[model samples]
Target: MKTKTVYCLSGLLLGLLTACQPSDSNLKNQNVALQLQQKALNSTLGYDLVESLTVEVGPRLPGTDKDIQAVNWAVNKLQSLGFDKVYREPVQVPVWHRGQAHAAVTSPYTQSLVITALGGSVATPEEGITADIVRFNSLADLKQAAPESVEGKIVFIDHKTERHQDGHGYGKTAPGRSQGAAAAAQKGAVAIVIRSIGTDSDRLAHTGMMRYQEGIKPIPAAAMSNPDADLINNMLKRSDKVTLQLFLSPESQGTATSYNVIAEVTGSSKPEEIVLIGAHLDSWDEGTGAIDDGAGVGIVTAAAKLIQDLPQKPARTIRVVLYAAEEIGLVGGKAYAKAHQHELHNHYIAAESDFGAGRIYQLDWNVNEAAVNALQQLTVEMADIGVMPGNNEASGGPDVSMLPALGVPVASLRQDGRDYFDWHHTPNDTLDKIDPAALAQNVAAYAQFAWLMAQSEIILRPVAEKQSQ
Candidate 1:
């Protein structure tokens, strides 16, 4: 939760902020946006949608059968909710099978460990590799170490992810999980292991994407649970040397096609201009991706459903994109940028609800600074739900991060991600982690954001273009 957006709204509370409200012309829609927010706060639609998806579809890792099943579920759900249009766009995604993972300290003291293979990591030998452990405090240390210090050893990076309400710690500690293997492989290490990139003290090891260099040897990469890493650290302090045995069976199956499931509530007068909202449909196999993006799927879909119920349609289309393979590499999002290259100018704005089902506390965007003022009334309307205006510096969310650079301006309704990484990418990311009240708050913020933006006279462009002027 390091992003600080959660705690940065000190002076921007409704009346304390000045000269940021939209023009009087936009006052009519403010009432409508307020109504949408109230309706969403009382609705159980977000909780219900997530429950049905996680219970019925379970873990829908991309390229798996369940991924396709989730796609169908999304289409059916959207249509039943009476969206004007529902569709799927094909996206080719890399497929990696998580076979099995095992780790243990063989020397100093013998102890079995909980581990999970990093997504896209190569497999270890059939007999596995047992070697002396070479510990590094961070990936930078591993990169600085002499090859002689790491060769034939299991490189362990002990960088711990810090907890925050803003979820900024993940970015700081992620290099160890995403790039540690390649760094270790480059140095001739036989394998790489890192402290799980999560804040929980629980034994569930977090798993995420890791890449191999083109010409370098691909070594097995995995993450040990935080407690296991702590145990190993303690063992190192007492013993002359600690040896570890590692086994991982994950393998790549090349590429497979997945779909970005899409649904739209068409605008009454100006359907061509679109306000895009999204969440990923895929999740890691370790747990039901209930918090990672399943809640996001629920949030966006329910938000749009609320918008569609208005007596009069908004002026611009509201599009919901349930992205595919976000955990892999933002494959679906990249594909969308490519697929809709020509229509990008028509994208009024884009946003993604991928953090979790946390209460939203701030609204930020990567658009013209003037656009910020135009949406100020929106922030005021959302203030009762504890939301305030943030600066013009948001990438929206992971999947929609690509859109801002492609001429589709992006916004973020910042959720309280303080505990997001506690269960992120782990088996602990289950349905029980969600607070229905908080999830309802998210729905309210998103519904308000989407409806207000759709009906506003403001159409945002990339921030860079305006900033340069």
Candidate 2:
């Protein structure tokens, strides 16, 4: 009896060893394939894409001629790049034109100040508005001020944005830009000006979206360049009352047609399942939108192009979506969610590259708890490229925020955004701001992860209750 038991144990041990050998060999093969793919993506394709978008189709503000040109360009470029299917989905976008903007200190000190109208801001009268300046250290201060004190005054919300690699400072300071006008309007201020939500101290004022609440009347809102804000602060130190003249001729031209450009590399097996990668196509009219989102379009497109060049198709389709009108409030993203409500469940994974051309340092996911192991393995594979794992609380990007909210798994390849806001919405956001080598790294990282997700059979969706137990 003892001899028979010993023989059975030996057989079981041999079988287990044989099973582990193939698993190890398969892992080694996967690593080799990933490395080769990464090497191939470290090329000039990403930079060239950015250059083409910026130079050929400059400033693609939604609903404008340039916006239509950009959509057409994207469709042609994607088709030329060998995408199996390239198409455009129509989206309705609000058109706001920035005509002429100017500001000057009138009393106590006379100096021209650099300013840009915030998106959705109402225009001042033809003669413009000249009023005594009332300064608040921050939005909180402005909110606490009495209506009588703020009435008949140009309220300046002076909140300075800090620089950080993760860009948390923008969120901290951006409230003053987005809601400051409404808050000040509630306090009876004639207009509102906030220090630009930027990291640089340059004279370029960043322009972004601001909202007016339903009940509160819209007011003229603008962002003063950091240096100009400093000038205003310095002048206020010497005198109790400072006056300023402000003029902006921006106007809303009602609704206009825009498009979301989509291209796909169809899957060999589960073609219905999707791995979606996205970037916003529309940019602020201030610059070429290179660092703000042209880099993003470049990175994702280049990555998808590399995947399409692979010898065999991946298991799931890889779809690249170029969103429209992201600067004003994710107009394209919301439209997409509403249009594709039924298919949202099949979106296996989604990610967006909108930060800049900065090198990726961290990867965060909003995937199911069951897929944590798959994400951990991906991080291990990405460690060679300097990408570390981050917490699971990921927002993806501005354009794809709705995906995570709908329970579609999303990932965030966080870039070093230390200097992104400095050139974000200003004329400084040109192709010169992107580093070719950094852009290549971004492509490599995105390609590797996107390819892995496309090929793997890992279930990224949340497990059912019965399956979890």
Candidate 3:
């Protein structure tokens, strides 16, 4: 019996030794760590943050009192979240107020019209301006019209939108809204109105920023609701000599100081290397900016919070930037680029969630070929969260676009934009529009990506000149 026991003990010791081989042990440890990370990220809490932002601070347009309040709210929230550092950087933003917008058909038929001021549009006089309405089937037609034909007339360029996942209709139909003022001014038109570039058939109008050329006259511009646009079209179909009146009091009220809210979670190992997550702080003034960016604020902050809660610190730092005035010509993005130009090389990856709180369907990236394999691996890890590989031509969000010039690699978690344009920049944008499950999924994806990127041995691509050397 003693001899049998000795033999059994020796066999057990040999088996243990084989199992403890370095490579096998490392693999076991890796699998265990991965499981822990997955568990930590599984109970994502993005909805809590998003709900807090949408319900608490709401509608943070730049230069407005609400915008300032939002900055204060974000600062307090970040500090409460246990971020290592939370601060605000001031950005001098253009202040344009939409006082009141009114329009009506005077000649062919008398009826009221619903309209909203286009961003950056100059206000019309108090009494408003009445002029003969000229109809243009498209931008090309407006451009070819005789100057005298459009002089002192309100130009209407009616172009319909078609739906696509990428919001391609916006690109195809934007010429009317973006250049209508300048194109009409060049043709001697007084003011311009275009059909809202949205796929929805509802009466709500979508408003966005519009630019006038340097030398051209800056005229009042506005977008009419789809139904109202139909009314105008119906009137024009009967006669080309319809008369219209427009009254908009949108004005530039000098200058105001808006701020971008920033926070950081320090890393244990490579502290200098940085991963950035961002969302726009400023929203359009019409409605609460819930879907547009409140969802974004929720997503990034929750991701950071999850990382902070981890037992071990990530290998690299994570920065959360809530940009200001993204709605008005990327004012905050440009300011951030200029302010952080020196640290661009340190940015390992930057991403922003600006689209509505729809489910994230795809992930795009803008990094060198070397980064693809790593991102592909990341995609597989996030597959349960419904994230798929997307186009590599990632331009990033409006705010994140500024980072690439500094050679910062970008990651894109593309959300489902199927219904984004419906409530985007419209008065209907509210907290109820967000899906709690979808928001939580977003948090899960962001948390996992940020954590793995921070912890991974593989150095991400777009390694700046300074880092590579």
Best by lDDT: 1
Local accuracy of candidate 3 as per-residue lDDT tens digits, 1-469:
0111000011122213111222443333234334433553565456677667767777777898989988988999999889988999999998888888999999889999988989889988889989988877778888889999899988887888877776667778878887889999887888999888777778887788888989888889999998998998888779877888999998888879999899988988889989998999889977788888888998888888877877777778989999999998899888988898888888888899898888777888777655555456544546656788775677678798767657888877888888888888888888888877777777777776787667554445553333222
For model 1, the superposed segments whose C-alpha errors exceed 4 Å read: 1-25, 465-469
What lDDT does the true structure give each of the candidates? 0.87, 0.85, 0.78
Separately for all candidates shown, the number of backbone clashes (residues 3 or more apart, or on different chains) is 8, 0, 0
Return whichever of 1 and 2 wins on TM-score.
1
Instruction: Assess the local accuracy of residue 43 in candidate 3 as a C-alpha lDDT between 0 and 100.
Output: 54
Off by over 4 Å in 3: 1-44, 463-469
TM-score for each predicted model, relative to the true structure:
0.94, 0.93, 0.89
- The worst-scoring run of ten residues by lDDT in candidate 2 lies at 1-10
Candidate 2 residue-wise lDDT, 333-402, digit = tens: 9998898889989998889999999999988887665555455654465666788878667778887887
The TM-score of predicted model 2 comes to 0.93
Show the colliding residue pairs in model 3: none
Superposition error at 114 for model 3 (Å)? 0.6
Report the lDDT tens digits of candidate 1 across residue range 390-459: 8788888888787777777888889999899989899999999999999999999999889877876654
Q: After superposition, how far is residue 439 of candidate 1 from its true place, in Å?
A: 0.4
